[model samples]
Target: MVTPDLTTSVAGIDFKNPILTASGTFGYGLEFTDFLDLNRLGGLVTKGLSAKPRKGNPPARVVETPAGMLNAIGLQNIGVPVFLEEKLPKLRAYDTKVIANVFGATEVAYVEACEMLGEAEGVAGIELNVSCPNTEEGGMIFGTDPAALGHVIRICREATKLPLIVKLSPNVTDIQLMARCARDAGADAISLVNTFVGMAIDVERRRPVLANVCGGLSGPAIRPLAVWMTWQVHQAVEIPIIGIGGIMNARDVVEFLLAGASAVQVGTASFVTPSASANIVTELEDWLSERKITSVRELIGGLELPPRG
Candidate 1:
């Protein structure tokens, strides 16, 4: 039997293990009970929730690219009211850190959502999805603006006392500015590379694959990018980082750790295997046992840069 040092912390939330279910892929935390031991994993970031329920984009909302996939989920959710009244009450029974992943088209909406989560019981923390484009001000606003990012975080910060996680968008020219913006705005932690903007085409039909025209790209293709962003952000900020993007197994987890991620979040991998996160936890246990590695934190920023000959 392998006993891995499963305890991991990020955004002030303690995880049972470093293995976690990423948002959007895992649905709500309750969906994984049949496929996983929720308590065995690190924690769960629930599906992106907004101020109101959304039906999401049209049916062709997702499409596969060369080595990744593009998605425009439109942040579909059951709204804050539904989540608090119907969903959060159920999540309280589970023995794990319950993170509320929230989004909105406006700052007021975000504040309201955070306030609602703050009042709700059983919530361990709040993960802000500020990457969403502002609906009223046109699509160019929100995530890309440093000032806008700061406003959103500050409003939410004042609204609640829960640990805040500001998810960054990878579509910016200078991610460091955005990371610093979040850090300066009182965020406890940051999640990097919230999907690169991309789109695919249906060859025969000669039309855009996804009805949204453009969608966020994720999966193996963006792995290297994610690592680089995590490393850069790690060097710039003191807050813990949650490395996501193309993490499929223990090896990937170790890679993220070396890249300066405090812990790892499994996203697209969950779709391929409902039990992928737990399997990764097992594999990590086996790897650590065989190597006699005591704690996973020892591996953080452990990567050695190549010598310039």
Candidate 2:
């Protein structure tokens, strides 16, 4: 009887399943419709949206490293108004959960993005990208400071009625404080950890490989750190946690759920396999059925680690 079709509700918004595509990695939900059925996903978190269109960082903004990738995409996105006018209609037709990713260079920009999304139709919820570290002034790099995190969340809180999921950074000294701040500031849910800030050298050129020099690190290399952070934050706060980073297969998905995440975001994996979400979702279902579980929700944080002898 165990079925992957178990429904999950986070912050009052319901998801058909818990597996979803991370923002930036998955373009507007419509873009993937040709490659894969839009309805197969548990949810779709769209690319980051700003108050205004962004050109993003200059050339050579992404560099491939062994095991991980560095990205300084700078939250490049079309402005909120355009998304509302153009993308929202096409997205609204999809059968999956519709989560919008909002970003800003300033608290005001954050508020504006949310306020706009709030007014748009068919958008299920909002994911606050307050901690992205790639921007010059506002990206989440500032959120490592609790006061700033609180301020940014509160600002967005004032602008919308949709469920708010605050995304946190991994670069902070105490990730818990940031997660707590978001919850305390009225966030309905929390997601972590965003890419770790990292850089690489060209060696041959004697300079950084990426033109931005520094970017967020993602992939299997940061999976342990991400799981640790997710568990810690889930224990510290009352809001639901959506774990991200290095999710390559079914076991990794189970690890995140056992680590206390109510949901998981699959990022980089989608780059090579556009159908990655479909496979992960199916694998999760098969694992649950084989384990004799009747519902996928039963797997949420169902881990019991061995005691120290």
Candidate 1's residue-wise lDDT over 1-309, tens digit each?
446576878877888777777788888877888898877677788888877787776667888888788887777778878888887788777787878888876788788778777757788888888674312322235678999888888889899899998888877988888899999998999987678888788889999888888888888899999999999988889898888888888988898989888888899988888999889988988888888888887887788899999
lDDT of 2: 0.84
Q: Write the per-residue lDDT of candidate 2 for residues 105-194, one digit (tens) a residue.
A: 888888888887775678888998877768775466556888888888887888999899988888888888888888899999988888
The most accurate candidate by lDDT is 2
The best candidate by TM-score is 2
State the displacement of the C-alpha of residue 269, model 2, in Å, after optimal TM-score superposition. Answer: 0.7
> Which residue runs of candidate 1 sit more than 4 Å off their true CA positions?
133-140
Native-to-model Cα distance after best TM-score fit, residue 11 in candidate 2, in Å = 1.1
